[model samples]
Target: MNRQAQAVVLLLLGGAVLKASFTDLYLRYVKEGLRPFLIAAALVLVVAAVMTLWYDLRPAATAEPDEDHGHDHGHGHGTGGGHHEPRVGWLLILPVLGLLLIAPPALGSYAAGQAGTALASQQVSDYPPLPDGDPVRVAMLDYASRALFDKGQSIGDRRVVLTGFVAGGGPGGEPILARMILSCCAADGRPIKLGMAGNAPTGLAEDTWIEVTGRYSDRVAKDPVNEADIPYVTVESWREVPVPKQQYE
Candidate 1:
């Protein structure tokens, strides 16, 4: 690749990063906390591109006659000043093009299906009491941990609200309320799901975001330590909701 091509690639990549950061699209792939770092990286790439263009377009000095070599053979393969540019640099454009044209959607039910629920073992601690509310809004993962590990002591008979995308087991089987948990980005994301009891909605489209109001059911693993199949929620009510801005928890 030529210097001009390198500069253009840098500029395009930098612009894509800046656009994703400014438009909040970065949240689809990465955590919101990475916004500042993304912005800084975009600035650095833009600066480097500008510098490359400046140096490339500057005036060049007149070439002197090659009196030392004494041979006039114009073979450009000589090792004196010639440098080979790697062809692999062209691959950089693939991501830029993908970002501009395809613009992949955030991970949803399909991804959740592939990465089945794996609840992290909760450490023994004085779990806090549920907040004061008729239907306390609690995360799906939080509800699962509380119900499975803490034996739903904090939940008691309190009604709670859990919000997540509907995944798997709905029509023939019971519906599963699932949320993606990400440590860094979508690539490292995994799903946490809670099985729903009672009357679940029928014919709900996959990945449809919904709010479910329910309480922990008595049906639980006899041995809590055994990898308990997803904890059950005795759903009392449910309704479709707009997909949240941040898809992952």
Candidate 2:
């Protein structure tokens, strides 16, 4: 395509990025902190594209008549003026179309199943007593770390609530609760899995968000894929819930 066509593509690309960054759609791919960067990059693309279009498509100054010939040949975009661009450049439009039309969802259970569960950090140590609540909320990572590294000493006997999506089950068919944690984007995301022991829910579809109240149980299982640790909890109750605004932690 020529400069004008390239400018149109560039404009569409900018619009796509701006749309994603301005809405919750961007969270599906990159961390929230990168929204500002996305917006900035989009603005730069838009400005550059507009400038290029203005320079390339604007009316050309009419040339003065030559002294000898006294003729005024028309001067505008000529048949041979088009730039030769690689066909591969056209592929960029595909992602732009997807972002503008159908925004993809955040990583979930099926993604979790595809990769081996990553163990919550092994630096487990004594945790301070949980704050006052009938059932204190505990992060999945914290629960896993304490359960695996500290042998549940920090978690103690307190009833804790955990939130994550249902990711099938363990090797023995025990129910599993999982959350994907990302350092930057979904490409770098990893799943944290916890096996449910008692009173666990059943038959929930993959990616079903849930909140479960359970006491920490001293149990651990190996991930069938890579033999990584999958912690355990003895669930007392559970209920389905809507997916959170921020699916990944």
Best by TM-score: 2
- TM-score versus the correct structure, for each prediction: 0.84, 0.87
- Pairs with steric clashes in candidate 2: none
Question: Candidate 1, residues 8-29: lDDT per residue as tens digits?
Answer: 8999999888989898588888
Instruction: Please identify model 1 stretches exceeding 4 Å from their true place.
Output: 61-84, 120-122, 169-172, 221-228
Give residue 67's error in model 1 in angstroms: 14
lDDT of 1: 0.79
Q: Where is model 2 more than 4 Å wrong at Cα?
A: 61-79, 124-129
As a whole number from 0 to 100, the lDDT of residue 126 in candidate 1 is: 51
Clashes of each: 0, 0
